[model samples]
Target: MKNSNLFKITLLFSAITLSISTANASKIDNDEFTSLQYLDKVTTDAFVEENKNKEFYDVIVGIEDDQLATALLTNDRMRKALEVGESFMYKGQEYVKTEHLLNVADQFRQDIKSMLGYDFHVVQTFNDIYQVLVTTDGSEEKEDVLKNLIQTGKFTYVQENEQMQLMGYDNEGDNKPMSVVNPSITNDRHYAEQVYFARQVDGYEGAASIEVAKQILSDRGVFASENKVNVHVLDGGMVPHEDLDYAEAVDFKYRNHQGKATDDGVIWVKKDFTREDDQYVSPAFDCSGFSSDPESENATSWRPDPPPEDEADEWYRYDTNKGLSLNSLHGLQAAGIIAAKSGNGVGISGIIPQENVNLVSALVVDKCSGGSADIMKAVYWSIDNLESPYAIGNSSYDGLPYERTQYPADVINMSFGGGNAMCFKRSNNYWTTAWTQVVQDADEKGTVLISSAGNETTTTFNVSPAGCENVMSVGAIYENGRPTGFTNFGDSIDVMAMGSKVWSTSGEVVDAGEFDVGYGPVNGTSFSGPIVAGLAGLLKLADDNLTPKQVVDLIKNGAKPLDVGFSGGETTCGWLGCGAGAVNFENSVRILLDGEILGEPKATHYLADHKQKDDSNYISLQSEFNPNLCSTYKVYGSVMNDKYEDLEYTLYGQVGSGDYEVVKVTNNSNFTFNKEHDNYQLSACNATTGNCSRNVNVELDSSYSPAACG
Candidate 1:
């Protein structure tokens, strides 16, 4: 819908007069827009003119809410000028174009250009927001241009585009030798190396139990292939790998602008890049001639030859050491973790079976860094391409119109974050507003958004997207069930997952000097986030109607608390800092299959003798209950020390129904009507989750005596 209005303006505007005025400069009174403390002003007037023709700065402008309605209405004259339908649905929403709104927007654009003396181009538009790239042809400084745009009161906010980075850490230094292998985990070639799925590794029990969950689903007659869910990975481009399956892959790294002038006297023509002849280009490092382009021939003949084939596998592992690297296969690695091909006798298995997921690769990152505008565009694209409720409609972009993708994404995995950016509204940052709006839009569609909690090892207080409300932020945990040293912690994190030396598909050829393998180890919260995302996919498969909030709750409710100081060690992790706990995929699956936790509450009963004030002996019966990781237990039922003689005298205390209360003998002593009778009945229920446990009957050991109570 927004794109339609932008297209109408581009075609209808041919030329316009410019009027520069500084009278409205003092009109910037909105605290939300004026309180931006992060933006630094450019003080050097000479520097602005020095680089006037050499640099182009991208600024994002948010249109005020009042203007959005005027921009959406279509008029008779404007309808005839565009020669299109009066109203139509785009991405499941209806929009109408108007000439009055275009004129107003065009006038504002002209006034800004006149004031700055610089060329402005609307690179992209979404939800009444504009990402305009300002070419440095004008003598006005960049900071002054932003202030002038905000002073008009027509825009909600205006700020420079910032940069974001992939959250994964390539821990190649800790990589294991290719020759090393463990066969105990599974038949998959690298299952053992994927320690995140193990029940217990290195004396710690923090595994996600992915294999166990899959088995549970199979036993319940729910086959993996029955799962029909789409998962979109928003990261660097995914390369062509035999271990991964893709429903669609699009690159937003480059956009070609064909300098053209609109009616507003503004040049605005930028088209998204398309692959050459629909050929798939691997984003991984090229080993052929050490060039980013694998097809390129080496200028010099000194490039090393590709690696030799392995005798056992009969497959050649390309030489990563020989080529110039393009970008880290961050997206590919994350995809492999989420939905790599399973049971094909190839690399490791994904958390979700390949047949169960339709992986959509939306490559927004180029090299290791990405601009905010590109990331935002990718977000909009992913949302728009989802299977819509109505018949898909054609939308125009830079004069070229196309149909939307029918595939829908139930879960979007953003394994990247900007630690320097804050997503809170109080910060009064435009980036925060932009991210929050996008996340809210995704939430409205019931799409689960999961992002890494960052790897700064501090707190996620200032992290973007992760800190945004309604987003499930995941932290990293070690095999020993302790929070990873590098994982950002605090109240913002929703849950924890294994992220230490995780083994997954590598973009570059691993072990180039020894052997060729495309799989290797990486460390970061980036990988941890995908594990939870894959589990969310499986949950969606179980129930398609589950909302994003419900999905997050299921995972958190089924998680196991971390073993902060196991074996009486000094290590400790607080509940607020460590998250809900380590995600247990198997437990989460069982919770979905059954109404409550799978196991019963553990409780023990003991008998002892106590001496009364008069030196008389009385038998004491005590019951103790221990809570499990999934929930807390509340013991229920009455305890009768002497069932036959003391029918009227009983030790009974029922804390409020379903309340978390400890049930025990009152005052550790009850008047004994008959010491010979010491039988009691009790049951426990999960106080935290409201799921009850089975009842148990206990009797004191027949050999025990009153002397033991001293």
Candidate 2:
């Protein structure tokens, strides 16, 4: 098996060793927990013994759910620091160093599993945060646990789990099946419009695909009457506009770097104009807004000035393309594929044309072409203020290094990656480790981290976090559905999507003078990541009952297969980096509708009904009685006939409460319905009434009970 598969298998065993219980909980009578210190010493000694044996997986922890537990979870002062901006201070801190504590975390997770039964699976975990997953089982207990964790201070806050975050629901926000509608009759409005391959235009007026989006929705029976794709130019102001001929007008607002509400907002206009006339915005390509002159002696763009205008300059220009602007091109291409409207006589329609999705622009690279710590600050800003119902964060930019801190998002799309390898055999870099931790922690908190397999003229190493198993790394496929020439290939890559010749939104506005030129084609796996993100969002909207792994599995299973002749005729295994194949949107919907999306069925209903729940949102349940076969039990309750009324005592099995022939149920009340029995069936009698009948199948399966009549 390959490394990732091996790692996954190993992780399962590792989790099991963490839950080897040492002592019984009932022995500790007092809340003072006098046994804790002894337990702590025992735990420390166990870690030491395991260390001596070099048994890394054999170590375990002794747990006490007393004051120490509460202290670890809810220290008001530590909470305050975290609530403010002091999380960085605890950068390298570990809450519990004992091996037993780690074991306890894993054990508590297992308890949750036992209570919720099979549908809930544990996805990922970091030092403190644990992501437990749930599907359509939709039990009341799941909500109880989520809310209790918050109140008890186990977690600061619990948003919708990553798979269901911002997903579409019933009108009352209840989790239910989503209905598809024709886009033609839908509301035609967008929060922002993005133009890919942006070129210089005189003003913000430029031809875009927003019109295409509107038309697509219109064809689907959804009516888009207003401008849903809002377009704007942000330099230093909230530019306000009211009229839009082709697309939509955008109103800009400003906030501080930390995303605090601010009053500074403006509308970008021609250098010399004072009025808001659409035509007055200048269309020149001059870099004048900068404090430093573009033509100054020491100006810093991506490239050095057209040096000396000589043969040497030609060589320099060839070696380094001056202002080729691949980043801008890449970003714009992704935006277009997502929201460019159709029918304005330009561009293709996007996946979500109804304006149910919104795009936010936070500049990480300044005009001087320098990146600072400000890039991450912009990330935080986007998290704080972007108000779209669903936010798909796409970044074609990567490099530098980062600390392993929490990044909040329903989905984060990364198309740029290429840095260190994470293996014991390879020498590790701190920067790479930190960045990997970022991916790990984000995933733990229910964020789906999507990344691109970096492009290569030849071949370089795979990106670190993308190569990490938990991430959904993607690669690019050309229009012909083959792996693109420059696309990176790797085992860590989870899927492939259209990337080459892809179109997207431009950051420049119509008034910026490069409006018309902004719309065009670009290629790279970076663009592929967002396409997957958008699809991921749509899948989430369709069925909130999917776990992250199930979602990934669905995408892989739903992919359209390509001819695997390029690498070799090795059809089965060579496509690891390409992940099952290219994403197939239409087929995905079909599969979801076919009921393939329901989670793993419980082995027995006896395991399903027993639960323990707190006042919190997530519920927990314990088995009411010992599960034993051949034990007689008696269950008493009224029966409901096919007609909606109650009936007298019906012929069920014998009335022995704890013996081999009968089962006893204590939770049922006098008004409750007795649907449980060893042998019960429904029989339609004559034309007017139905009779209660018994069958042998009831002895084999509890579900073989009589059906209730209408």
Candidate 3:
């Protein structure tokens, strides 16, 4: 009996061992490797299904947790295994680390590739974060599979679409939930009182570019001393080691970087605010472009003129006569919006009343490729060198792919959007994810982000940067209280500001011309973003104790809604499209001071629902509530404030659904004083006197209601 039991036990043990071996072999050794192979397929499928009937521009994936980032960055064997440019498949995905960065990101990229796929591309290798660009195949099937892969436990977080991240607008599926910032808990809006602004000026190349902004800022009351807005405009590239050391040098609270300096220490016009004559100037440093030429009258005159060596301040041309001319207006436009002084009769006014701003400028655009590498370098420089208490930066240029590894400013302004991603055969999903990480990081760092809603009128699509959640997406409203015809509309738009036809400094345009008040006609959400930034600056000035979100909510809720359609019937939904309506500066200030909370408006009472007859005329509903029952009630459907005029409504009494009973009432009071009923069934009468003149009916609204008549 004992022998028989032993035999049975042995058999059972063998069976269990066999089952374990089979499962392990299938997972790690089998050629099919079905479990790992299906990951990419599942992710693709999930991505496709998740974005069904939806359009996007890119796909972005979040790096695994810190633990994973550490392992990937420190692994040497993985780096050794990677070939210069060879792409490899890991698990179900494919990835290839750039040969240039293999030493830094090889292990990280390899691990992610082995787990996610080889199609993943590394964005920033230094930081613990390993952002991989998951190529969006633009197929619904692929999208679904991608979604599933991200949802799986294998990867920590996956961003299926990059465009969604860029716009900051979150779909229901975005796993990341924004933490609501309670303004009540936080105090001191300007956390950092003392800060530094440093700029890298490529020696000899960008002399005029750096000086113009410095001089202009000086004129506006901001000087480059330790006591003032502490502006450090360096005229050299702080590269690899020096860059790292510079990061260690400053006790930073805030930073402003300008100009991209190449490794050769040459200044270039990678990106700079340009005047009308194409002159380039940096508020900080200016880098050299691909080509160098003496400032000439040629069409391709982007080359920077080499300055005299060792004469730093001598090269600085304080006179307006010498500014490099560049074609791009984005950077200059952004600066103007930030600190342009008003009443100059120049261009338009900036968000702040005074121009005392320390701009940490950097030229990050490559003259040859027009890429954003230089800009990334500027961000790195700011992170290391700046010492300000609160750092607020702005990026007026757009159309660049989102790079999550780049600098995360406390407040970054993005005003540009919309390119034919379809025409380029690019999915905007990846861009969205990168932008999401930006906003997420900003939240972590207690920063605020603002963006423009974009100016795509022909197509019904929200623009990038604005679509991302956690970002304040602003749309343009004309000075006349009308929504600009070009401002993009969607649920993602958060607020509206005066963007259309704003007047401000024209930079070199005004320099060449007689106009000191450089004003020009500018439109789009780009202008709108600066307006918000300016408001934010003012809010900080007022209280200096508000959280980012508190300031945002205060600005949003305090704003007054515009009458007519959002921006005067430009949107399909008009009034509805205007998010929280238009901004009201005075009201917002009042709200902040008083700390009052207004409840949501009560639902509109409709006697009947019907189509419209014309633009001005509309169907009327019978009085659902008797206003005359009491002394008075605020009819809060649509009340325009001092900034705008109130819309007049013609209250008509209809016998039923179809019959019309037009009534005329005085426009002064909410009660619609002295309105006469068309059917003579209801009439207008004096409350104090019994005098009646063909205007009386028991069924009519007494005074303005049926109860008043009774």
In model 1, what lDDT does residue 349 have? 82
Clashing pairs in 1: 13-262, 13-263, 14-263, 15-263, 52-136, 117-138, 290-323, 290-324
Where does the lowest 10-residue lDDT sum fall in candidate 2? 161-170
Roughly what TM-score does model 2 have, to 2 decimal places?
Answer: 0.39
Tens-place lDDT digits, model 2, residues 1-710? 22221211111111111121223212333332323322222222222222221211110111135423322231111222222111211223324334454345445544544654322222212232222323222233433544433343333333222100000011222212222112332232322222211211212111112334233334434343332322111111111111112121111111111111111221121232223443444323223222111222222221223344432311112111011221223334444555455444343445544354443333232221221122222222223321111001211011111122232245555444434343112242211232344444554545555666666522223454356666677777654456766666655667777665454543343323122343434556766776666656555444444555655766665565553555547543254356666665543443333222211111123222334222122221122232231122222211211221222222224333532333322222121223344443221121212322232122223442111110
lDDT per residue (tens digit) for residues 1-710 in model 3: 12221211011110110001111111233333333222221222222223223322222344445444432331112332334444443222344544444434445445544654433433223222232334323343544645655654445445322211111111213222222111211122211110000111211110112122233333433333222121111111111110011111110000111111122222322223343464644332232211111221121212234445653322332111111222223434554555544344333333444433343323222111121222222333333321111001211111111122233333445554433221111253322343444445555554556667766652223444456566677876644455666767666767777665443333232221111223344555666676666556555545444567776787777555543443454433254376766665544543443222232322111221123312122221222344432222222222211111221223345544556565544332133223322332222222222222232222232223223223
Considering lDDT, which of the candidate structures 2 and 3 is the better prediction for this target? 3
Candidate 2 local accuracy as lDDT? 0.34
Give candidate 3 misplaced runs (Cα > 4 Å): 1-61, 65-67, 74-123, 131-264, 267-327, 342-348, 355-411, 418-432, 458-462, 507-518, 563-576, 594-710
Which is the leading candidate under lDDT?
Answer: 1
TM-score of each: 0.62, 0.39, 0.44
lDDT of 3 at 326: 25
What residue runs in model 1 are displaced by over 4 Å at the alpha carbon? 1-51, 54-56, 65-102, 110-120, 134-152, 177-185, 200-206, 255-326, 385-395, 398-403, 427-432, 507-517, 567-572, 597-710
Overall lDDT per candidate, in order of appearance: 0.55, 0.34, 0.35
Ten-residue stretch with the least lDDT total in model 3: 11-20
CA shift of 252, model 3, Å: 18
Model 1 residue 42 CA deviation in Å: 26
Give candidate 3's error at residue 226 in angstroms: 15
lDDT-superior candidate, 1 or 2: 1
